[model samples]
Target: MSIDITLTVNGREINTEVSPETTLVQLLREHLLLTGTHVGCDTSQCGACTVHLDGRAVKSCTVLAVQADGSEVTTIEGIAVAGGLHPMQAAFHQCHGLQCGFCTAGMIMSAIDLVTREDDLDEATIRKGLAGNICRCTGYHNIVKAVQMAAGQMEGRGHE
Candidate 1:
């Protein structure tokens, strides 16, 4: 049987039907066509499916679609504005944090959540925060730098 769910996604309220076993990643990527949230691994170890579930970073692959019923969900595609990118996404691009770009979306989403929750961010904190995300392209240095840069930008805006 299909379960009816109502959730706000990327600032849009959605009413959809999903099976009990349907995952958030599957709902976003397959059903909603929000392909930016990736699925890099079968295990939930990879943060490639990271997204903001009610403003907190979570691996979408690990979350059941029904579990997020009535919750707010934000994917990588949701963070940017019309003309400019989100600060974290811009930092990732500016710092060359991505190589193949497969993992960039999740990285930026995770970074935004990390920076949003933590203040006075540094290299160590950024690295520790990003422990869940794994980039096989050997781009950790740039990723850390991007997080740091985005943190600084977010801090300048004075919104914790």
Candidate 2:
């Protein structure tokens, strides 16, 4: 059976039909064609498929498409502004937070959430918050630095 669902992705309304077993990642990637939200591990052990659902980070692979009905979803594609990248994304580029870039999307999504939830972000705190997202190529040192950089900028700019 197929179910009709609506989603707000990248600030645009999307309407589609999906099977009950279809995951959120499948809906975004296959149906909507937002491939930036990578699928590294289908088991959700790796946070590569992370996306923001209702302004919080979630594993898209673990969430069913039907479950996201009427929700606002933000993939990496949605993170940029009209002419510039989000502060968090810029920080990642400046800090070299990614190597292979496979996990960069998920890491940025998770980092944005971390900055939103925490008032005081430190190395240890960033590391703890990012424990769920794994980077196989680059050590987390650069990732932590990127999060810290973005955290400082996010204080005045606010979280996305």
TM-score of each: 0.95, 0.95
Summing lDDT over every window of 10 consecutive residues in candidate 2, give the lowest-scoring window. 151-160
Q: Write the per-residue lDDT of candidate 1 for residues 1-160, one digit (tens) a residue.
A: 8999999999999999999999999999999999989999948987999999998899999999999999999999898878999888888889998999888888898888888777768789888988998897978999998888878777433355
Q: Tell me which residue pairs clash in candidate 1.
A: none
Steric collisions counted per model: 0, 0
Q: Candidate 2: deviation at residue 37, Å?
A: 0.6
User: Per-candidate RMSD vs. true structure?
Assistant: 1.5, 1.8
Per-residue CA lDDT of model 2 for 89-112, tens digit only, reads 999999998899999999999999
Name every residue pair that clashes in candidate 2. none
Evaluated at residue 36, the lDDT of candidate 2 is 92
Estimate the TM-score for candidate 2.
0.95
lDDT values for all models: 0.89, 0.91
